[model samples]
Target: MGKKIILLLTVGVLAAYYVYTPLPDNIEEPWKLTWMIAVSKTVAYLNLFSEFLGANRFVNIAALSKRQEVPPTSDENVTVTDTTFNNIPVRVYVPKRKSVALRRGLFFIHGGGWSSGSFALYPHDFLSRKTAERLDAVVVSASYRKAPKHLFPTQFEDVYNSLKWFLRQDILENYGVDPKRVGVSGSSSGGNLAAAVTQQLTEDPSVKIKLKTQALIYPILQILDMNTPSYRENSHFPTLRKSEVAKGWYDYFTTDRSLENAILLGQLVPAESSHLFKFVNWSSLLPEKFKKGHIYKKPIHGSSDVAKRFPGILDVRAAPLLADDARLRGLPRTYVVTCQYDVLRDDGIMYVTRLQDAGVEVTHNHVDDGYHGAFFLLDLKISHRIINHYIDWLKENL
Candidate 1:
């Protein structure tokens, strides 16, 4: 009996080692990496189980959170309110201090790959309130409709509508915010939506209330070329695998999953749109330092037939990287944060380059030890410092 028990224990230990040892090189700490791997695998398994049960996995996971458990208003000097903008639900955070002058306004969108993120989530909730107090600004965190339920343009519409609503004189005066000092920001898919809003406003000069600044945190700015430098480098990184990233875009863009396989394999670029390739081609855009050890090959022609079926993939609002240079000019000052290990790193870098070339003032911050989801790791000393730096930059710019 004792010998049998010892053998079983040995097998269990070996299985755990096998599962957690082969982490990506970018993750420097072994203990943290192991914990992250375990958490990721557990979530994956839970999501699979939820799928089998025919339930919304994200909603189920979110149900477990302690809702609105942010720091007390008295302590944080921030007031939190739940409200709706144009009938779309939103959460607003305002600093309590009375101001002689109107404060800056920020429209913050949460990141969840256009699906799972919610302001109700602890990190986001705390971050919003903390931002309002720390920056002494009126912060509005939007809850836009997600994809696979509402579809492509719906998500963008919600965000755009909310921004317009916030800029109204009545709303601006009520929150002690200056209309001209308003800015838009987001992370990941939220960043994509923020860029879309900025692009939309830039194209239509008739809009009276213009944005003063834009902040993007490791945003997925474009989908034209999936073979970016960071994409190739972190292809199978556990935090966010390249295949999974492609699937998220596919799910958001199309109702049918039939074309997903082709899309993932790089067979979606139409021949007529080939000229657009130069904007996203890694060989042309990325610095030599990022392309050192990675091999570059000519991408096989994606089926134009498949590409024609999904025209929105090329839309400037959907792929802001393709926006005209003229449209990029006379826009707000921008702040772009890139993570060294994130698959979306090059997307931010390319955006900064374009913004600078267009004569837009840009402040680019690259977190050397950061990963795609590093912002969620508030407990880690490194992540905490990075988060502080990000907040500090926002305050200074505001």
Candidate 2:
């Protein structure tokens, strides 16, 4: 019996090791990234067993969490409040150190393709807490309902509405935050929401808060041009690929999954937008350095039938890249981080050029060794270096 048990355990370990996706030497922390991807993929395959057993999966990928757990790590000088505003959950982090003046404020949105990540997750908690302690600012790590279950605009509404609640004078004062010194930030899909929310807040008349800055780390700025230079180059990048990221958006916005394969080839935009594409085509916004000599061909429109199903992907709120020049000009000072080996690399680069053209102050850090999901785990020096870069920028801007 003991020999059989040992044999079974060895086989399981060997299987997990064997299935790890190979990584190129150029990626950030290749070994660690491979291990993390292996674990996530293993969990994903294990989930398929539930379908065969005629029951829901034993684990909910969207809801996988351990809110009360804290791993052994550095930095313990922040106090956290797991609370809610406007009925949306938020994890607030305030530096424990005493201060005479109100500190800068930041709203952090966690990202797992907009369908995963939460305050219950440790990476987010650590990042938010570390931000508060390092920058000596108050950080509100907000949570929104996930997608495919909640549908489009609900997550946006939740984040924006709760933002309104947080910006109230009473709440800002109570948290030792300066209303005039507040900024927004997020990672990946959270980066998408942070950018969209920052753009929408520019037009909001009901909220008196003036955003001081925005930091988008590997944000998904547009849904249309899946054929951008980085997209062509990094579609096969580990963990977050071109199709997997678009699939999350598709699942979140609509019930139909047929658009999955078509959208991957940049074929989902409505045919009626030819006049609009001239302004947004790769030639206009993206810089030549980012183009890397890739010839610019206009996107092929999806069939009218394919276009009819997901008409809203082009909405500025859904794809901040679609926002008008006037609105983009009105945005606040911006900070953007792009990983060289990421599908979203061109998204950040294009936005930086667009924002700079509109006279908005911009700070961009292009990490040559970075890839998508690089700092998400916070298990390497490279991740901390990225965090420090943001901290230094926040010190100057916020």
Task: Using TM-score, give the best candidate's number.
Answer: 1
Total backbone collisions for each predicted model: 1, 0
Q: Where does candidate 1 stray beyond 4 Å? A: 18-29, 53-76, 293-295
Q: Candidate 1 residues 1-398, lDDT tens each?
A: 99999999999998777576465555557577668777768768887798789987657645544342443343448878889999988888888788889998999998877866687677887778778887888989898887677677888889888888998888999898988788998888888999989989876655778899899988987776677779888877777888878877876788788767765666667777778777776676667777776666545567777777777687877788888788888678999888888899999898888888899999988887778877766666656776787788788776
lDDT of each: 0.80, 0.81
RMSD of each: 2.5, 3.7
Q: Give the Cα-based TM-score of candidate 1 against the true structure.
A: 0.92
Q: Summarize candidate 2's per-residue lDDT along 121-183 as a digit string, tens digits.
A: 877777887788889999998899877777768888999998889899999999989999999
